[model samples]
Target: ATSVRRGLRSTLRLGNRLAEEWWRQGIAWRAMRRGEVVVFDRHFFADYHAYDIAGTDLPLSRRLHGFLLAHAYPKPDLVIYLDAPPEVLLARKGEGTIEALARRRQDYLSLAAVTTSFEVVDATRTLDEVTSEVIALIRAFEQRHGAMATTS
Candidate 1:
């Protein structure tokens, strides 16, 4: 989910409705059809839609918690939660901006409820370490479920 923060922020603006439909519905549907690996990054939870858009203010956080408990999204086959101490992340980010921290914290907290397909890890380590950890997790999952191989 190493995506552009600016683009994600824009997803909240009015101009992004079309982009959302294109990316979420159109793109995802096509990917599934093609037997492709559709890697959804963040906030595809149903309640993330604004109250006006969704027709009621259902409290996104609580809704997400309940949704996770019911084995939603198939737990995505695997969920790699990259976590680090706030201070470590702050040091790595340098600017120590509250806005940046807030965005990251929100993402992390939301993922905490997920468990079956999730592996929470310390991200204060090296990039190679993170990659190795993720690979091990995926391999273990594939062993259990049989690999869902894709070609392009």
Candidate 2:
């Protein structure tokens, strides 16, 4: 068990490093620098281990990696968490067991709780409704930040 855990941790570290590098050179970073409203389908925060698995019981390296990944990147101006029941998520994705989906949902909710700029939208709603709500959130953010002006 210890060996398995060690292997997982090593893999996670490498994956995190690669992901961070990619993010630094990714479209999101470029758009942000250009003063555009970036709509990420899934952001870094969404990928971090949640509070449940992020306890001190884990190795120091694992905990440190989680901490750095959670804080390293520039935070999104608005985090619209489109939340739905685990069953709904399972149905939509056609992958993952209900148990796994539920765990992921809890992780997302935990992350949302600690985020300063977070909004939960009912993702089970009709596509139009969800899109409208997301648009409204974006508009509100733009209003607060002034219209996003792209750099030429």
Candidate 3:
């Protein structure tokens, strides 16, 4: 019965994630179809890998579901990971511990390494510097795709 309960929980979670992904993707698709550039604050797979589903403490069911959902989701054209030292992240967030933040940062780096279009911008820099770097990346992507800037 415990295994059955785990299965049910996993199934429900998978369904919910898929539904959310479908809705979010619809928004992105519509925007892109209108020749607009869409930037997502955080991709679902990256968040899952860092926070919820990557740890060994999680059940096998959840890990499996996460794997499925990750594969099902479409890969982004560009993934900009704003990276900073763990101490800086902890100070800024006032939430997670330094060690935990460090681990999560490493996870993000690993994810970036695997992705085709990934950039790690130094978030420890000034806001203008970071913004400029991100803008440059987007502009490069737009140029490569022959896309004219429709909106800022």
Candidate 2 residue pairs in backbone clash: none
Q: Which prediction has more favorable TM-score, 1 or 3?
A: 3
lDDT score for candidate 1 against the true structure: 0.55
Model 2 poorest 10 in a row by lDDT: 44-53
Q: Best lDDT goes to which candidate?
A: 3
After superposing candidate 2 on the true structure, give the runs of residues whose Cα lies further than 4 Å from its correct spot: 1-26, 49-53, 147-152
Report per-prediction Cα RMSD to one decimal: 9.3, 4.4, 3.8
- TM-score (all chains, Cα) for each model: 0.53, 0.74, 0.82
Winning candidate number (TM-score): 3
Clashing pairs in 1: none
lDDT (10s digit) by residue, model 2, range 69-115: 55664555667889999888888889999999888888777766666
Q: lDDT per residue, candidate 1, 1-152, as tens digits?
A: 44565545544543354346345645665675676556566434422322322324444433443344233333345566677866777787786676667665555556546434667767888999988987787778778866543321
Per-residue lDDT over 1-152 for candidate 3, one digit per residue giving the tens place of the 0 to 100 score: 99898788888877787788778878888788798888989877677765444556666656765665556666677789999998998788799898988887889898875577888899999999999999999999888867733322
